[model samples]
Target chain A: MNNYSTFGTALHRLAILCYVLFALFPLFWLLKVSVTPNDLLYSEGVRMWPSRMSFEHFRFVLAHSAFPVFFRNSMIVAGATAVIVTLLASLSGYALSRFTFRGKYWLVALMLLTQMFPLVMLVAPIFKMLSPLGLTNSLTGLVVVYTAFNIPFATFLMQSFFDGIPKELEEAAKIDGATQFMAFRQIVLPLTLPGIAATLGFVFTAAWSELLFALMLISGNSAATFPVGLLTFVSKFSVDFGQMMAAGVLALIPACLFFLFIQRYLVQGLTAGAVKG
Target chain B: MVFDATAGFPESRRRSLVDRITRHAEPYLYTAPALILIVTIMLAPLVLGLSYAFRDVHLLNPFSGGYVGLDHFRTLYDDDNFYRALRNTLWWTGASVLLQFVFGLILALLLDRPFAGRAIAQALVFLPWAVPTFLTGLNWAWLFNPVIGPLPHWLYALGLMNEPANILSNPQLAMWGPIIANVWWGIPFFAITLLAALQAIPRDLYEAAAIDGAGAFRRFTSITLPFLAPTIAITVLLRTVWISNFADLIIVMTSGGPADRTQIVASYIFTQAFRALDFGYASAIALVLLVLLLAYSMLIVMLRQVLMDRA
Candidate 1:
């Protein structure tokens, strides 16, 4: 037998098992609900697995509905916002992390102050501001709004990443006759890939799931995102659990795929190789 | 294009111009995009919100409005729903943050041990963090369904609940349903941050404690807990600030329903601006939330100062 306390170790293992199961059970249920035949939803009553499985809802959502358009719209908005914000954040973050400039402290304080206000307060004014410019119902408008909202946090995220990198490498590149921008692009940019990936994934997910602004700005289904589309399952009278959960399950795929694609970089602490201890 | 003019200009003026450009060039180049976007998109709306808050603003009354000078705030203060929303928001921000920190601390400590399959276990624990907030809210809403939910069904099977009760339909339980969901979603962040800090602790500390004959509980108190304190405090602050602004969860789960029972500041503001179309009053309530967040941030700064002094 092992010298370690069997009872304590077993208890620990049991606790971990319980927590993992608890955390994962919802996703399992989502998959389960999505597969359950619509007729058996109420009659079968909380069964872990459905007696019969069907892909009818997914078929209906994909082919016979506007969900595909909504899906495409979400992808466009998320992709554009992520790319734009990351590009903006990387430069600003590098400056914040490396440079000592005039009014640097005040600029940082101003950014922090912007974050303090509730976003809801800004909605009406934002709408008022956007409507006049013919931007209320456009994908570009959504991207603009998301880029604005995500930039501060992304900048901070990128700043921390930049801080993790040593300044000596850039100095070395400068001494070798490269300009600042050249050094940043050639050396620092490659090292900051992990941070950029994380920021892109973060901003993408945020824009994808955002409902409030999308709801407020877009009136028609043309510009409506998946979150707003999910609301269509809710009529005034009765909530359609089958279609809603089905849509919910479908909406998770892009996010899942995005994470799966970027998960490698996300898990790797890339700053480790950028600087020597 | 202006080479001849540059020669005609004073030498000192020319030198200063070059100096200015060189001195300011890099930071200006780097910060230009962010500053332009932030000023136009963020700052303009902020100023516009403040001005809209003071006017008798409505959706139909786009910009042509009369000044109301705290009238909206007064109406807001008198409204019972506002107070309820404030109370519920306070409970949400405070309770969720504290409970999440506690559970995360416990989980992190357990996982910090040398064990097989620890990485897989950590990933599973972090699954909730990756799920979208709306989806998480929907999942919890289903889990608390009265007739056909696993949780209530299991509770009934275990002889815990009287009936397969709709927890979200209940005023007392509905508020907590979202809070519980938030805590579950938020725990992974705290766990990850704390685990990183825990891994940085020197093994010598534990060995020294064992040499002094300190048992597991004693070691936890004397070594682990103290070392983890600063990280715990900072992570808690971050989670609190994030959770206080949480609208997606509340909006999807309840829509502040069952008699405005679960309304928090953020969701309340959403409804006021969107549902009621009362922009002025909504902006006032949002300003209230802004003030609250500012105060909490000040507290975080103070906490950081204290932690630095202790270090």
Candidate 2:
């Protein structure tokens, strides 16, 4: 029995190690190629690590290429979308948590319907709609679209967080002459800081990673998001694997940071939601 | 005191009426901004997109946008690529979901066991879900490139290939590239959800079962599977719909390449609209996909209802 248990433990650990390596290997490769010197890239074929590394790719991508602009544009759009979506989602989520009102059911159903359909269907029509208003090729346009796209999911996320808080806190404030909105803003909002952060991070990552809409809406390098810019660069300069990987590495940074920040809350938040759901 | 209270009651009654009106409008007030945005941005475009399927709308053609009922759908019916794409969608969604669910379940079960450094292990294993989809596509594509990537060489050494050639260019093997990338990216979603569900299964059940001389496998089969069934059902259903629509990996890696072998319906629609500039045809394809997804969802919901009723 002791030997059997020891064997089981070893198997479990080995399984875990395999999963970790599989998860990290591609990312490891991305980093490795990005830092490898151009002179050694072809010569060091299939190496786990280059004999020597340099910052040349990163420097070229930063100074000579249009990646910095794309990065800045992505940061602005994602930041704005995160802020806007979180704010709207918080209010609506609070309402969903606290109130039983007309249209609440329909509102949720509509949001779920949005999730079920292909957003690609909206690509052409949205372009037509925005083109007339001169919203195409603009970061503001991307932010608006991303905010709308993210609101439904973020609202549900925020609602789950709000549901975890006791209703009595807001009810107590309400009885003490606070309006419902006032109670929400002053009492409830501050309590759900973790949820707010998670939603912000979630929306930020999503907006940062969005590809198709960014590709369709933005025409030029000046307004392109990271994904679109990288893709365009991939096609335009197919030879510069090192430079492209460096850009790819840069794109991974903010998302990984946000993921690390919110992953704990992500599981916790979902568990609460799932149990309640 | 009675006279003073009577006088204040009328004033308070009027104030209370105003408060009642405000209370009734409060939720709507809170939801209005989000609702308005959804309507204008998502809902309205969806309706317009449906209409676009019936009209002849071309991006570069000034003479287009005329009503041409059933024209695009008629064309879609005869388009060989559309049928091929439909077939590919099934294979792609099935293979990706199956692998992700299986691996995710295993990982979740593994992580459920408490051990030293479990927290860090959990974080590391779940890290892939954070990589952006486009980057996931690019990273995997690069990994399959024969010149820079080691995969071809490794496969050759293992006698799985004739030589160190890029699989992305091989029609028979190209779909695997995107599917592999997708599986790697998607496993965390299932693991996170399943792990949560696993954790929710009462620990006392396992203890009680063990006390009754039930083995580990027996306890899992009797306790864990049943507890996880509902979560598993819903997550799998939702993920099926989501993954069918996910074309980023395919689009980035192969662009439905070699011979359009990887052209799933979602990517096919994208190609039509983006590359061919045929919005009408794209919307028509999208409409078909939408109906199919709705039917799948409806079927799942009805099945769940039937299962619940039986229970």
Candidate 3:
């Protein structure tokens, strides 16, 4: 509707192209160096593409390293955290959305306060607390920590989604002799699938990329998550750039898969609501 | 369609005593599991961490759990490194947030306009946020390397530098290394949120304004800016708090190094607790940080309230 001049339009597209390049260039270089053979790495001298590319680095990382175990551990922790956080967020979010209760405003304020606190404050105490219970250095401990860390934001996110659905649908279900919980399960949840998917993706990627706590809590090879593993790999190999970048690419795959889901719902105004539906 | 008629029925349902009690308890029931977990996992640890600031609780020393009232705080008062970290924290948070917001807003405005291949472009541009922070730090660090990476070479050729050198090593410029990487990683976050808020804007408002002879700039100022104000305010406020607390990029890229020029309070706290095993000192710094952050949040909130009341 605001289309005015071709010159203006060209400038806008050019600006967009710049952003895309700026966003992708670092990642592109990651892939470039990861594939470039060691001899060509220094010899080629900053060529955009390698003179000859090979999978030697990728092969080495996958075959001769603890990365695979770390990868699995990270997946399990992130996946479990996402599922648990989403489930709990859905319930709490539903309460915030649909009910008028005592202390509701305080509940909201408390959640916001949680967000404001420096998470670093909790690291030492959390380690100390978990150590006595034999929960330190375990995947379960990581999952529990991650779930609590993510809940406040996820609750807010899911609440926004729940607010978007019209109340009429659930009321109709209730009028037909269905309970509130039943209506919520059968009628409300199906419509909020997109919202749920987005929350899952957000929380999963957060737990996956979390470094500070993971590094503090876990030690040794068996239970190490990918971020911890990546750091250790760097020090152990002593600047093997190709193998490091190769491991970095491998670490990015799950996030990329979930990114597809996030973008789809995110552009749809985060839910199938009437205003932007 | 059948729901519409019942939606107007406001009398609520008849209920027995048990049902009334259940109805009163319903929201609590729904929220209990989450609330319990959060209290135990996050809230309790936070309280414990604060108390640790007053005691000597070294992790390795079995005899270290002793009351040491005000000792840590007294040391913090005199610590030169702590003061330096505070100064650096301000710089890092200010520069990172400002740059990210400006670039992110521009990106959002660009993406908001309809164009061919917009979906693909949006996805591609947002891809940086998906790259984990650790990798982002490592990747940017590598890019600034003088040998394998092209950036130092490009800067030298452009006469920005006399010789190809890594800015990550220069104490004066070391902080920029992480700030630049942070902007790249975090812009997509701001863009995604702003774009969502932008899309929620009523399209007809713009159309009506145009028909009334308002120019593009005038319409944006009178309409778009007003609509975007709340999102912009909350995002910037929360992001400021978050970015200040964020230490991963600094730790990964520079390790707060090159003569400790890049050391932020958050990274300093992490290093103390994680590397030094000095829980008492780490918790002490963390408490100060927590107080400062809380005060900052309170100030903004009150300021916003006053502004809203005026408006």
Candidate 4:
């Protein structure tokens, strides 16, 4: 029995180590290639680490490229979408959680159906619609579209979080002459901070990652998000490996940081959702 | 805030007609912003897109956007690429979802076991999920490059490839490039969800099973699989639908291919709209994909219902 248990422990650790390597290898390779000197890029090839490294690619990308504009545009779009989606989702989610009104079932069905259908269907029509409003080719348009696209999922996520809280807290606040909205704002919202953070983090990453609509809607480099910008880089300088990987590393930073910060809450939120479902 | 005059008023102090109306209108008020946005930004566009299927809405043609009356669909019926895309979508969605789910389940099971350094391990393993989809596609594309990446070299060394070459340029093996990247990116999602579901399973049942002399495999089958069934069903169902629509990796990695070998319906529609500048044909293809997806979803839901009834 002792020998068997020891074998199990070794196997478990080995399995975990394998997973960690698989997960991190691609990212590590990206970093490795980013810092590799131009002279040794191809010569070093499959070497786990190049003997020499430099930040020349990063410097070039930051100084000479249109990446700064793309980065700023993505930030604006993602940040605004995150804030707006969370706010709207909170209210709508609270409604779904607390009220039993007519059309609630249909509302949920609509949201679920939205998740199923292809968003690509809307790209052409949205471009046409927004073109008339002068909303195409702008950061604001991206924000508006991302928020609407994300609301259904965000609302469902927020609803699950709201569902985790007991009803009595809001009821107690209401008994003390607080309005329902006040009870929600002052009483429940504070307790649901983690859920809110998770929602914001999720929306932020999704908005930042949106490509197809971003591609069609924004043409010029001035308004391009990271994905569109990256594609342009690939198509333009198909051989500039170091600069592209460097840019990719830069793009990875914010999303990964936010993800690490809020992933715990996400798991907790989903656990609640899983149980309820 | 001022518009909602009765918003601040208590029920006892304001039992008047305005208060009653306000009380009844509260939920609608809460949901109104989201509903309006969804109707305009999502549902409205969805309806317009449906109409574009039957209209001539070429982007560059100033004379386009007229009623074409199923002309695009008639063309699509004979389009060999459309048929190829439909077939590829099935292969792509099926392979990606299956591999993601399998690896994810294994990872979840592994993590469910308590161990030293589990926190850091968990974080690292889940990091790939945070990589932007475009970057994921690009990084994987580079990884399969014979010159820069080690994958082709490793495959060659392992007797897998005849020589070091970019798989993205291989017509016969091109689809695998996007599918592999997809599996890598998507496994984290399935892992996270399944891990949550796994943690929610009552551990005392496992203890009880072990106490009854049930082995590990036996306990897993008797408890884990059954408890995981609902989550699996829902996640797999949603994932099937979502992945079928996903085309970023394919578009970035292969642009639907050396010979359209990797062309799935989602990416094919995107190509038509953005590359061909033919919105009418794109919408027509999208309409078909949507109908097919709806049918697929309905079939699965009915199958699940029948399975539940039998159980």
DockQ of each: 0.55, 0.81, 0.65, 0.78
Regions more than 4 Å wrong, model 4: B1-14
Between candidates 1 and 3, which one is better according to DockQ? 3
lDDT of every model, 2 decimals: 0.82, 0.93, 0.91, 0.92
Clashes of each: 0, 0, 0, 0
Clashing pairs in 3: none
Task: Put down candidate 1 lDDT per residue, A55-119, tens digits, no spaces.
Answer: 88788768877878988898999999999999999999999998999877877876776776667
TM-score of chain A of 1: 0.90
Among incorrect, acceptable, medium and high, the docking class of model 3 is medium
Instruction: Determine the C-alpha RMSD for candidate 3 after optimal superposition of all C-alphas.
Output: 5.6
Worst 10 residues of 3 chain A by lDDT: A268-277
| Clash count in backbone of candidate 1 | 0
Decreasing TM-score order of the candidates: 2, 4, 3, 1
- TM-scores, all models, native as reference: 0.92, 0.97, 0.93, 0.96
lDDT of 1 by residue, B1-311 (tens): 49988889899999878867875887977988888888898999988788877888888665746799989888887999989998898898888998888888888888888689877787788778777787888888888885446888887789987888877888877888899889888887777777777776778999999999999999999899888876777677766777888888888889998788899989998898888888888888877788778887888798778978997
Residue pairs clashing, model 2: none
lDDT of 3: 0.91
Candidate 3 structure, TM-score to reference: 0.93
Query: On a 0 to 100 scale, what is the lDDT of residue B72 in model 1?
Result: 82
What local lDDT score does residue B5 receive in model 3, on the 0 to 100 scale? 60
* Isolated chain A TM-score, each model: 0.90, 0.97, 0.93, 0.96
